[model samples]
Target: MEPAEMTSLRAALAESDFAKPPRINLRGEPIPDGLTTAVVYQGHEVVTDGSKPLRGLDRVIGGS
Candidate 1:
């Protein structure tokens, strides 16, 4: 991606409610401080606890 696109993407994510990803992993375990996880579902990155869709992820990722 271009720098401008990356900047826009970062700005969008920063302004999103799911910017702070879930604390637990897919296994439902407590994530340690300073650590994070990336979960992909149906070819899209989602902020879930193995159940719910991200609060604002659909807008960010343009998923239906």
Candidate 2:
């Protein structure tokens, strides 16, 4: 992720009710499971292990 985008995401996460800091899973690292995950890549194809992006991220605010 770009620095500015990462910063914004961090700030937004901090102000939210996420129980833990978001994990940054990089290539060669084992991907986490059973949690909300966002796989960001520069391409039109998405190859998650069956994970999906959270629709309406606003709904996650305040731990809802």
Candidate 3:
């Protein structure tokens, strides 16, 4: 992620209700059964595993 994008994301996350440390399981190691890439925002969990692709990233970063 770019520096400016990261900064924007940080700002947005700060306004959310239940933000957590985002994780990306892109490595080869075993990530447990249910572990996957995710972002928590406003008490909602958005997950992106192999079965589904991540979406609305631009919106997440305060972009159109």
Cα lDDT tens digits for candidate 1, 3-64? 98867766666556443565343546754553343545334454443344555553456522
Q: How close is every model to the real structure, measured as TM-score?
A: 0.39, 0.32, 0.34
Off by over 4 Å in 2: 20-64
Q: What is the C-alpha lDDT of each candidate?
A: 0.51, 0.40, 0.51
Name model 1 segments beyond 4 Å from true.
19-55
- Best-fitting candidate, scored by TM-score: 1
Tell me the deviation in Å of residue 39 in model 3: 1.3
lDDT of 2 by residue, 6-58 (tens): 77666655454343323332344455663333533332222232233323333
TM-score quality measure for candidate 2: 0.32
Q: How far is candidate 2 from the true structure (C-alpha RMSD, Å)?
A: 11.2
Compare candidates 1 and 2 on TM-score and give the better one. 1
Pick by lDDT: 2 or 3, better one: 3
In model 3, residue pairs whose N, Cα or C atoms come closer than 3 Å (at least 3 residues apart or on different chains), thus clashing, are none
